[model samples]
Target: MTAPRFLQIHWLASYPGTLINRDDSGLAKRLPFGDAVRTRISSQCLKRHWRTVEDDWALNQIGPEMAVRSREVPEYRVLPALEAEGVATDEIRKAVVLALAQALYGDKAEDVSKRQALLLGEPEIRYLISKVSEIAAAAADAKSAGEAVKTAFKEEKANLSSMRKNGVLEAGLESALFGRMVTSDRAANTDAAIHVAHALTVHAEQGESDYFTVVDDLARDAGESGAGGIFDTELTAGLFYGYVVVDLALLKSNLGGDGALAGKVCEHLVHLIATVSPGAKKGGTAPYAFAEALVVEAGSRQPRTLANAFRQPTAARSEAAAAALAAHLSSVDEAYGAHEKRHHLSLQPIEVPNSSRIGLDGLGKFASAMASA
Candidate 1:
């Protein structure tokens, strides 16, 4: 087998105030790491942020090619497309159910009002619409349209197979990167090319509770009580470490071997991670922050994470965390020989001895370098 080609992105971000990725009891998320409690943000939360960025990018960059994850595919997408094609209302409705069942559930799908929500990329949607339209055109009535849709399944099986083989059904950037799972049709599932780790604070710190009161201006004007509500919330402040790995080869394959598209994805992903802040109590705390330091590594070798550098938490306000991570990476490379190309970019001035350091202004250049790698 060919060696795995991967891109690993690591960063440190510092934030202040109460950002609650809460647990069952409504406290900030925390986990025990390296014999100390560290604030935690789930991978799911991180992925949600990244996916949202991806969605926005898709809308603005490639609107027609964007995929939507929803169960109302028929009502929202298929029906609208068929209607636009001047298909009768009744014919459109019948075609919607039949087409969805045929495309999603194959021969096993029954006539149902709703199907499970799944990621349907633009290519898949277009294909489904074309098939449904063809069936609708051949039928004399709605019932006949439904029957034609069902009969066309076996007749068009070869076409479906070819589409899958050509990766035509997996064209959207989000689907290609994040992957999709169709339990009803295993062949439609695409393996995820990206993996993100749970973000953790570089220093061990307990969350602090802040007690405050909310005063109502209207009540004050009406000569009411001084305070309207009083509540307490837990917050944490520290430098956080985040790590993500993307398999370049798998990503290319997922995008149907379009190198240019893969490059765009790589560039966008890096930009997103460096700029986007994960979800939190933004309305109250507004702990909006970006990555302070970013390290990107790309190569055809096994990927490694620099998380171990934080086994011993650094000072809260010191640059020791970033320094220690750089040192650790350098040490590893010295001992084992370098297998990947590394690039470092920072918002602050700090010397990472062995790495070619770039300023924030060069972020796009850094992303371009990684994509080229």
Candidate 2:
């Protein structure tokens, strides 16, 4: 079997009375579609919800080391490791850390460097700490310790450059999957292996402001009629259509050609996108809802969105949205002649001309076919 180059996941989730994503203006995010404005959720919000969840499907389980994004890596990670290596002089440690931080970030103090956050893998941090320790141990005082960092980096510039991709990872598992951009070192940048599209409602924005008041127990005890505070929050309800595309080859390469790990990651990702909710007001709104319908496609052709099916907006229901999706797929197939293998998992049946219906577990098996190839 020819390994598929891309695996695209499409789903329809119904979230009622929950503002999944909002704007700085304290309103539900909106997208202007063909004739109406639709409630929207940003890809960044979805990715953050997916990546940071410490659950059975967490991405952290995909590897031995995880990545930490912070600007104080030199001060926190590097200094601690150096201190343990008998670099007892506080002046030397602080001076060396400042120099290293400036190099990693820029030629600025801690305040400036604090603005530039970098995602560095634990392994990468360990490497940096070891190198910094070596320089610090050789220096006689803080002045020399600071200069030694610059001199060491200059002398080992060629060797340091290889750190960009020597281990086949830009930094760590998260970096390999989501990617990283280091302005100070352009060579360290890694392209994202997964691409996500912002989720948009299949219909025009369905939202309202919920006016609420908090009662003051003390005031009530004193027979007061006024509330402690009054506020209103935006709430939205609709069937959102979300899309995520995994570049198989790039994923395997990022994980050091471990197709098995990539396959496992793909399995967990499919489950998360289908089951996880990105709702904002969880406690009050209880925005817990799973995908009503999911469609997975594996193909070699360029990945395209089926969002146009709702260009004019569908009824505010899952069945209507799923039907619209299937019809659009059929039309696309009639024109392009169905170049991909597709599978469906849903509460209601959806028929794509050349597609197979599968259970949720079957979704993983279908995508994991790349591992065998």
Predicted structure with the largest TM-score when compared to the true one: 2
TM-score of 2: 0.93
Error of 2 at 277 (Å): 1.7
Clashing pairs in 2: none
Model 2 deviation from the true structure expressed as Cα RMSD, one decimal place: 2.1
Clashes within 3 Å, all models in order? 0, 0
Candidate 1: worst-modelled 10 consecutive residues by lDDT:
55-64
Q: What lDDT score goes with residue 340 in model 1?
A: 70
The CA lDDT of each predicted structure is 0.72, 0.83
TM-score on alpha carbons, each prediction: 0.81, 0.93
